[model samples]
Target: MEYVASLAFAKEKDQQDPLNKFREHFYFPQRNGKDAIYLCGNSLGLQPKNVKAAIEQELTDWQQCAVEGYWAAKNPWLYYQQYCSKPLGAILGASQQELTVMNTLTVNLHLMMLSFYRPNKQRFKVLMEAGAFPSDQYAVETQVKFHGFDPESAIIEVSPRPGEHLIRLEDILEIITKESDSLALVLFGGINYYTGQFFDIPAITAAAHKAGAYAGFDLAHVAGNIPVELHNWEVDFAVWCSYKYLNGGPGAVGGAFVHEKHASNRDFVRLGGWWGNEESARFKMEKGFVPKKEAEGWQQSTAQVFNMVSLKASLELFEAAGIGALRSKSEGVTNYLEFLLQQLNGINFQIITPKNCNERGAQLSLLFLDKGKEIHQRMTDAGIIVDWREPGVIRVSPAPLYNSYQDVFHFYEIIANIASNA
Candidate 1:
């Protein structure tokens, strides 16, 4: 993975990249009638070229079949979610019975909490990383309050030591041991949005289990960006949104997972819905809920056909490329970004993301001590699209599916010129 800070070198890497042709699969934003250098896939992914055709097919089905589209449509809307299970199961490292597509992230988080976060006199607190995505913080806080506990006291957050940028593995494990008596659940984002740190799910799950607590993850940043073994990790449950690395279009359908051990436990305390019932009994319009024996039991309602078609289209590309193939490309491109950024002598910034490839995904958070926001605007003006976060960070991600080494090199060139001027 030797990298050179030259356009020809960048192009050469792109030329050799087996996944480089995937750039054509996405629609990039236009700048002066040309495709912009898009490094913001960690925010909102580029649209798949096949999305329109996929949606149009559904549109045609709805028009021709009307209400009968549920059964008569090409994909059969009644069981539309089944279409995604094969690919998604591979990405999450779970069996088909252990995972299912469902509602938005926070909604699914609340649902998982309902079933997995049951607490008692000796164990009622929840342990999570500090600086998690705000929605997670809110979900955990409200869930604690729902069970009649004060959030401040009921929630334990592990933070980095002073002057440190990332949480240490030992600290997390030690805190789990120290708080084992009170911890009812251990929840975390698979990858921290701001720091772009990929937590060790296997280690985290083992610690939580040893502490006599259930473990879950919000995988919004982890799903398609890196490889995981959720079933092998024995995580109790997990949830994720599909828009970011999954490239499922904005506000796409979300996914949820539970271990197979819990999938058949009809007595589990889950918030049930009509669609979640056994399919044979579902149409009987019965009075009581008889849940399905699989992850489908957690479903609340019918699939959102329109919302899922885009994801279906995206998943096809993922299946063809394979998660392992994508991860290899992701590492190469992200390393190229780090290499170029390091060559900049005085950029008034430091990369806060973990330097180890396994410790991160596709993103690099450039923490600028000064003019971070202004530099972000400059990046935009220069037709380089990246995300900006509070305080002073420019989050750049060269998504392997649609971004190239040239994209990272160009970002470095623009920021370098801006830094020199300052």
Candidate 2:
């Protein structure tokens, strides 16, 4: 496809897009009385137009049905998690039986680690990417300490080579091999938050299996941004937040996946709650904890009906758009963004994200030589919503759901303007 940097060309592309109608489903932030170009879906997504109605329905159910709303509401608050299953299954590439909507990402991470990160004396080390999100770092650190192991010794971080932003696949595989003897678990973010590099899940999973270790991922950035086959990849477990690419509202309910082999195993050890008990037995309130014979078995509490309603509203859009189609459009638009950024001659910055579309999602991380914050502020002032990280990187995420080709062009225009002024 020939790329053009003009606004007219952008409008042409958007005009021809089948998913273009999706942009209307979200309510973008207003700036100067106009819709702002929101590219911050990698942080918090723009709210879906249906969210208000979704919340209201729940409120109505609570008012009309009171305690009986669990069974009486239109959505049945007792089974609210079920409403999200089909769409989340498609987005995360796992079967409904292998998936569950639950607590936030880090809490789910801790639960999965407790179930899968069993570190014995001979094989007690956990391998993860260096510079993972702080929550993951903190969770792994505390989990190691809770298990009475020195974090410095029990946690092994694989870092990129000197002066490189991306962690190479070979390096990850090599480290797993080198630490095979003592490695108990291999955990990574499906896509690194800072670099936006999409890690090779199948390859990593195979390597961990070959090394006799369990493989897992925090799919905070990967779940809705790209297609993944967690079950096919034989990923032992995975977790994600809904607010990012999933377009759930702020602090939306999180999701988790457990491979069928483990999800169906009646004896799989996990912290259990009444909601996870067999439905038939739940009302009995007995002593024995018999978990559901699937991913819901990991649930530790009743569904957060209000916390999950927004995600339920958002998933309807995903079901209509399809993750596969979204990924296809993502590759094309993200490529256009890269092409336009490359045409900028005035900026002293390098794209730190992997160049290959297959190795990344919808984000581009601009590593500026200087004035990173200044340029980020310039973009904000120009009504282009993007994110900035420390150490000179600004994250521009063009979410395929709501962002248009025009949005990319305008983002390029703002950056080019900033560069020209400098």
**Best model number under lDDT:** 2
| Least accurate 10 contiguous residues by lDDT in model 1 | 339-348
Give a tens-digit lDDT track for model 1, residues 246-352.
Answer: 99889999999989889889988898898899999999997999889889999999998888999999999999888999999999999989998988865689999
Over 72-168, each residue of candidate 2 has an lDDT whose tens digit, in order, gives 9999988889899777888888899999999999999999999998888999999999989999999999999999999999999999999998999
What are the per-model C-alpha RMSD values against the true structure? 0.8, 0.8
Which pairs in model 1 have colliding backbones?
none
The collision pairs in model 2 are none
Task: Judge candidate 1 at residue 196 and give its lDDT.
Answer: 97
Q: Which residue runs of candidate 1 sit more than 4 Å off their true CA positions?
A: none
Give lDDT: candidate 1, residue 117. Answer: 93
TM-scores, all candidates, are 0.99, 0.99
Q: How many backbone collisions does model 1 have? A: 0
